[model samples]
Target: MDASLEPRLDFVTCASPAGLHRMAYWEWGDPANDRVLLCVHGLTRTGRDFDTLARRLAGRYRVVCPDVVGRGRSDWLVNPAFYTVPQYVSDMVTLIARLRPGSLAWVGTSMGGLIGMALSGAGAFAKAMLAMRPHAGMLPPDQGIRLDKLVLNDVGPRLENGALSRIGQYVGDSSEFASFQDAVAAMRANSQTFGPHTDAQWADLAKYLYPEQGGKWVKHYDVAISQALSSQTAEELAAGEQILWRSYDAIDCPVLIVRGAQSDLLTRATVDEMLKRNPRARAHEVAGVGHAPTLIADDQVNPVADFLLA
Candidate 1:
């Protein structure tokens, strides 16, 4: 850890159908740097998940890691239905307008990956989205938040039901732990697919996973997020898959898909299809890891740093 590499906490207010909520983000490197990297975490995680990777590339890019609404220091949605991807995309649009980066790149894990995929193809809706904020006039209407590059970490257009079900089992779990170590242990058990981590690394990630509430360590995210996850019907899921596929097909920027070799979420078949569908895309796998590579290990971080720099 870089003793001097701590991030500045920041917040951006986002609009939702029910009302407005604040989204917290950790900003690193030079704030004036126009070349920006937006790092988003997975479901049930907070922005701190990207601390290692953000520090690695901070000198070259202004890295911003957000605790997406309903998680971390961000405000939870009044209505759980607002927890979907479209809302996330809209919130990001407002954020992009605020940053107004000269160039932009994305590093999204799991749910974050899907948000990136959706936003990459959302240019046509930019005008309407920009209307949400009057001062958003800084971003030109025609450009519409185009990404220079995108990295999809352990995610794709198609998500396996079994893996999702595995996640569902604990997504909204209301259990509280008596101590932080106990909470970390519980989180680690559910996150076995994240592959192995040093005990220190595990503690680092868990620090942002829960916050003291009622003098107990509880899950950081709004439990209602699980309500949104569970309410989706099969037809709704299929429709979303089609939309994501179309969005993925439309991406023109250089893309990288990082997968865990033993992942049950992003399968080899999906990666194969992704490569075939988009020539600008490439894939890399981390051995001995499942669902996702934490991007903290040297091998994991090196590949990502090289890809972003290239």
Candidate 2:
């Protein structure tokens, strides 16, 4: 742990229905600090994905970045089929129990956002939630809401298939990146947050990717995550979306929704409809990006940090 960053780094494991898996998380700032920040990454992303953001906020809050089960150093699920929001939520709940105090400030991206929403709706985690490019709705009976100060990053009810496929290049296969710089270049090119990455940021993600047999780099997540996506049938996907929609209606915490202007995942109509029901909700679009906005660059980090800290 860097002495400058107050919170010490600790590794812990949680035994969920899936099995026992190690979750390596970085806890920065002062351990005694009551202001806790939980930063979760998108699907196929590891907890280390938040290194830059965690480092930036270390001075003010106890930042916790957990490697969601099946990603990074976390153990793979006994049943790959359990690699959904519900399972992730179970593991997170366990993590929260060990963390104690039961409440936190959340920063979730993509799948992580959905998990946060589930926890909030169930009244089990976090005092405030900031979902970056979050997936809308968790259960069918519930309608999506617009809460004051919520940031929804470039994600909505519907997504553009082509753009989704394009974004897949970065998250799915790290083999394309010969070095960490290549990965950073790919992220900057497709990322909504526009800025250059420092050496530290690049080094952070570098430790998360490993070289495979072919000398190609691969993310440190279970391939089962990808298999989960491909194995889903259209009907099953729709059912899952309905479940999430109902759950979204139940979240009562302060929310911020930030959308990427060019994101194909979050549809305009969905945003409009969300605003219609939850008039309290606010939306912002990041220009010149698509699918998702990685919270690495200053532009992205500042907005998220401000929202959570506020």
Candidate 3:
């Protein structure tokens, strides 16, 4: 086994009256270092998604990546309705309380970015947040109006056609890799937009993939998360936007939004509005990418590292 950078890995649990139980995460870094970084994953992804990013950041920050409720190693909710942001926010609050830290930095992808937004507000946990290709208004509150600009991909207002099909594949797919290198190759193949990776980068990404009972390779995440996205209605989608806007306005911390140039999930108009609302927020658009920019390559990772390190 590879030597753990963290001496110990702690398993934690949190509960919400909404009847959701979330998993907590802690990776032991330098005992005396006070800086903590929280990396959250997108919908249908697990906490392991940050393996590469976290390992790279471990030297300077105690990186904590939580498997959001109903995903990865976390418990699933009985009520799919509870999959909304309110429930997610509540669970994250419990996580922040447990960490008991004075400040934090966040790296959030897609759905995860919205969660960071919820926490970056005046009373929330994060001191700064870097949001990548965030879902425009997948929440119940962000329906109607226009949610096409928050991200930079071709995802339709209503998830249908091959989009839904593509999502289902990752929600719980059947694929296997013979070795860690195999997994990395798959990730790189899937993430060609980010460009090439060194062997080390591939290994870093491989940590997130695992073999299944049937000996098939797949990501380490929960299958039920897809249900959460399926349950949202159009009205609910709009409501999610309202919540997002509120949280955006409430955020007092530094905010950076990195959008994929080819993404249909977030529209330019919406991003413009967000910038107007939060003058403190800045944005970066990655060319030749869609929906999200996996911060694996130097082009993607360097800017993020500089932002958080600065």
Q: Which candidate's TM-score is highest? A: 1
The models' CA-based lDDT, in order, is: 0.87, 0.61, 0.59
In candidate 3 the C-alpha lDDT for residue 83 amounts to 69
TM-score for all models, in order of appearance: 0.93, 0.76, 0.72
lDDT of 1 by residue, 163-226 (tens): 9889988997889999999999998998898888989999998998878888799889898899
Per-residue accuracy of model 3 over 1-310 as CA lDDT, tens digit each: 2325543345556655444364746464564566777777777656666665676777887677887877656777765556655567667666666776555777878777776665554232122111311432222222121111122112211222344455545555445676656777776665554444577765655565454445556666555556767665666566555555666676666667777776656666666776788776677777777666777666776767767777
- Which ten contiguous residues of candidate 2 have the minimum total lDDT? 124-133
Tell me which of candidates 1 and 2 scores higher on lDDT.
1
Give the alpha carbon lDDT tens digit for every residue of 1-310 in model 2.
3645433456677654446767777677777776677778777677777777788877777778888878776777777766766566656666666676334777777777777666555432211111311432122112222222234455543444555565555554534656656655554455533234466754554557553435655557776666666665666556555555544555566666767666567766777766665645566666665556777777777878787767
Off by over 4 Å in 2: 1-8, 16-18, 123-152, 156-207, 211-216
TM-score of 2: 0.76
Lowest-lDDT window of 10 residues in candidate 3?
143-152
Candidate 3: segments with Cα more than 4 A from true spot: 1-8, 18-28, 122-210
RMSD from true fold, candidate 2: 6.4
Model 1 scores worst on lDDT over the 10 consecutive residues at 135-144
